[model samples]
Target chain A: MRSKVWVGMVLLMVALLMISGCAKKAVRTDGDVSQAGQDAAALEAEKARRAAEIEAARLAAERDAKRLAEEARLREARNQFMNEHIYFEFDSAALTPTAVSVLKEKGAWLDKERAVNVLIEGHCDERGTNEYNLALGERRAQSAKAFLVDMGISPSRLSTVSYGEERPLDPGQNEAAWAKNRRAQFVVE
Target chain B: MNFSDNFLGGRVRRWRRGFLVLGSLLALAVAVCPSASAADYGYIDLTNPYLRKIPLAIPDFKSVSGDPATVELAREGARLASQTLDFTGYFSIINPGAFLVDPKTMGVTETDVDFKAWTGIGSELLITGLASLSGGVVDLELRLFDTVKQERLLGKRYTARQADLPRLIRRFCSEVLMLLTGNPGPFESQIVFVSGGNGQKEIYTCDFDGGNPQAFTRHGNISLAPSWSTDGLWISYTSYQRGRPDLYIRHRLENRGAVVAEKGINLNGQWVPGRFELAATLSFSGDEEIYLLSGGGKIIKRLTQQPDIDVSPTFSPDGGRMAFVSKRSGSPQIYVMDMGSGHTERLTFEGPYNTQPSWSPKGGRIAYTAMEKNRIDIRMIEIETRRIVQLTQGSGDNESPSWSPDGSLIAFSSTREGPSRIYVMTSFGTDQRRLLSLPGAQSQPDWSPNGIQ
Candidate 1:
């Protein structure tokens, strides 16, 4: 996001510089030998300068709009990567098709952002023993990491941890809360 | 002390546990309990499936000095004695109010007598004691008698600094337990458990009777799965103090420690019996597997190579074998591995979710938690016969079953009464009761040998 904003600012500055250069060109044209001819030339330069400033302003606005749109898209993707947890069924670490698709989308984003690394945290519901759930949580994390690695993300870039039942996305005791809790989550590094 | 020695005559009895000698005092108990000593195997057979709960009476302890200080000390001693014995679940403590004779006037000797009154109250056994306090020191003389046989079973006189009154009562209880069950009761033991609601849990320990509950770790981080080192000087637990589930091996007293902050999860540390070595689950290899670690948290060897998760390894009392939870069999189930040969066998067949296997200190049995239809209960498995016995009825989730040092009882965390709390029951699934009550929730009780030096 920072890089995109930097690019947008750089483009805006370039457009401002172009508009100022067009005005300078118009000023240089004003000192011609014939007054009438020079006035016409100045008039022509002003028309061109006005057109250039208008075009520059339009270009800057377009660039800013594109940058904002791209940023919103990136924000959504990152939010999806972090917030859209790959859920697992109770007492299981196996990935369903839905989980696989989520991992694949995350994989694509990871592919684009080469330098980014992540920690995959596995969590469990409040059932079962805490100690065993810890292992189950780890397995869920590993399965998610493996899916990402299989999708071409470097294994070195993906680390894993198990929170067992200590953490819950939903603290309620019902199935809905439990379904939200039995998941593998991501933290970007 | 001399009279105690004469009554407690005999040599030490050695067992596989190496026995808790407790200096010459415990050594002096053998010559005592003439009626009980004749049956050296112990008056109570703990492993007997049909073992009946002994109906024991603990009347008020007499104050020799009869002053307020001595009187208070005597009353406190009797209360502590009765509470600790009742915790073992081997004794059904008869209410003191039922005694026909006032405990204030009862004598410690068999002749001070009212044996008929005790028998009439259906008390199979009786514990009578007296306390004398002088100059910040207390001397307690306690005796256990068989009401039906009209015989003095065990007697001991313990002297200690006044503040050590609890220790005096605990020691006497140990003596009574030795005569009755052969093994000293869990009175000398401390239970380490995770205490805190939700986040930032810490390791807390209390006496066997839920006395002196204090924080063992002040990490102010999420710490889980604490187990005691064999000698009780060190504690091994997994702490995320550094933002990872790393194994921490710290001394129970002084600020000394070791760490195995491996690449991935380093968790569920279990100390080998009578050794500084421990077994823990590590995922540094990108898969969670059990590995042996030195006391200082250095890796020794990998114990499991299953394709799936293998964790929560509990070693047998002899350290010859380990039973752990593994998903190699498709679901979480208990699996026993021969530590010597590295041969592993699945232990439970009926439950799809059976975990937290605790190897009893005695032998052959492993107690574990089983979950069905979202409810969890504690169950035990016999090694040779593959016998499965449920130790807890399903109520709220009963999880993380841990065995006491004596193996006569099992401790675990239960959510039966709303918020979770630590609880214990007889090994045969009787006398279920909450072990302690604290402000916050507590779970994962690991009963260790005496933790204080």
Candidate 2:
């Protein structure tokens, strides 16, 4: 009866040792699973931050390109306005009907752009004396200015200068070149 | 006096027929003897259309001093004098290679000149010079001889620094011209013009013969309509240097300038004949008008009240009248106004366009540009007789005529050679020749008054 009791105590000790070893193995496995889950969450957060940074960079580049294109468009529009010249008859400062129509368009533009100041450069054909041509050019510019003012553009926003026969648009001495030369040009200030 | 007395007596005898005959004789006499009676010196018939250029001989000058520099200068002086006289178009220089008399043996005195030798070479006039150099100064004695008359016409001596040889030679030549013609030569004068080709117009000046071209203004901008002050110490022009069309006066010698008038469109500024005042076209009143301003550009008087353009006011030599261009008649025409009485009258009526009126220094005629047949040419009008003379025709747009101070020649700009160039011609529009062959086109030439210094 004493030997039977000693064998029962050894069996109880073996069972208790097996239960403790199983419980330790289960805790180590759970710790490793939680650590791996925390590492995956950190990597996912890093990847989302990189994607957000790339998207922000792409948006900035698009904004810059749009701004540049808008600037070029504005420059082209301004150039069109500046390039519109009013031509005159040879040795005469009197504005033609065509010149009046062109000036009307310029006046409308000027009226809308009140903040922009302009300079009217009066030019003449290379036919007369420089002094008299200067006077004629001034008269041409004044005529254009008057037309614009009559169309409701402010006089203070405009100034006139005469280049006389000194500056020719076309260097040819023919009538076609002269017709192109006798003009009133615009400059934005 | 003997010739005039005989002529007048003969005219009085011929005039006894009637008052009309007397009038005609008087007119003829006056016309024939106007310049001859004014001076005792022999005169050339400049008005004769068939008049020949006077044959003049200038041999190599004699070196009075033993210095080598003096010998070199003597040779240069003779050459310069010949060149200056030749440019006048009134004298033809005889070749030195054809000279019969040795100039070294001949002296600068009438007694020392062999008049027979000079007359033998078809020379009507002779010039002899003797030069001596000492201490960086040259003493030159010049004598002009009427070889045909075997008399000394003029004798003068000048002493100056080495660098002043050109001036000395010019002054002596001017004296020679004064003795022959009633007016001095334009050799000492300068021409102020606008030259452009480098994308900017700049004011430039050259000698009367188009030598020694120098930039008068280096503003690197558009500078135009240069006019010399009466004293020739200043030049007034319109420049865009200050970013606007303003009138600026520059000192020709000091290399300094100032904006004289910045009013609305200060276009053309010309000095009054004897005063420091300027007559310019200013649009300060909202319309272009001629105005008289002080040398500093202070407005002294408003010369015109026209609603149209009144520009390019040129003062009469006496300053009692002003001639300018006006558009009050529907086209540009020249108008003259009396300063004292304020009486204005239109001076041009023949052409549809008449502008750039430069009143003659002699005070009776006005030179201007007239447009016809889509081409422009130069024309002049007489104030008294209302006679209009066309000076140029079919010459490819000749304009901007400025008379030489003596009124013997007119310097203008023309595009006859494909590019605008400055040209000079006689008052009658003879001998039209290019003034300068510069790199770029040049225009608006104003000849300075003679004897600037």
Cα lDDT of model 1 by residue, A1-189, tens digit: 999999999988898888888888677767544677978988999999999999999999999999999999999888888888989998899999999998889999999989999999999998877877887888899999988888889999998888999988898999999999999999997
- The C-alpha stretches of model 2 lying farther than 4 A from their native spots are A1-77, B1-50, B65-69, B255-263
**In TM-score terms, which candidate is top?**
1
How far out, in Å, is residue B273 in model 2?
A: 0.9
lDDT of 1 by residue, B1-453 (tens): 212222432222222122233222332332222222222211222343224557899988899876998898888888888888888766678987788888887667866878998999999889888788887878777777778877777767677888777776777787777766567868888899999875889999988867789998888889989999878888889888998888888888889999888887888668899888999999888778999999988889999998888889889888999988888878888888999899988888976788888898878778888887777888777777666666667568898888888777888989899889999887666677888888778989999875242
Ten-residue region with minimum lDDT total, candidate 2 chain B: B1-10
- For model 2, residues B240-335, the per-residue Cα lDDT tens digits are 888667888778898676675554688865789988888888886778888888877788989899899888999889999998999898888988
Q: Name the regions of candidate 1 deviating beyond 4 angstroms.
A: A1-48, B1-52, B450-453
Please, what is the whole-model Cα lDDT of each candidate in the order they appear? Answer: 0.81, 0.80
In model 1, what are the clashing residue pairs, if there are any?
A: B7-B32, B8-B28, B8-B31, B8-B32, B9-B31
TM-score of model 2 (CA atoms): 0.80
Candidate 2's chain A scores what TM-score? 0.67
User: What is the model-wide C-alpha lDDT for candidate 2?
Assistant: 0.80
Pick out the ten consecutive residues of candidate 1 chain B with the lowest summed lDDT: B9-18
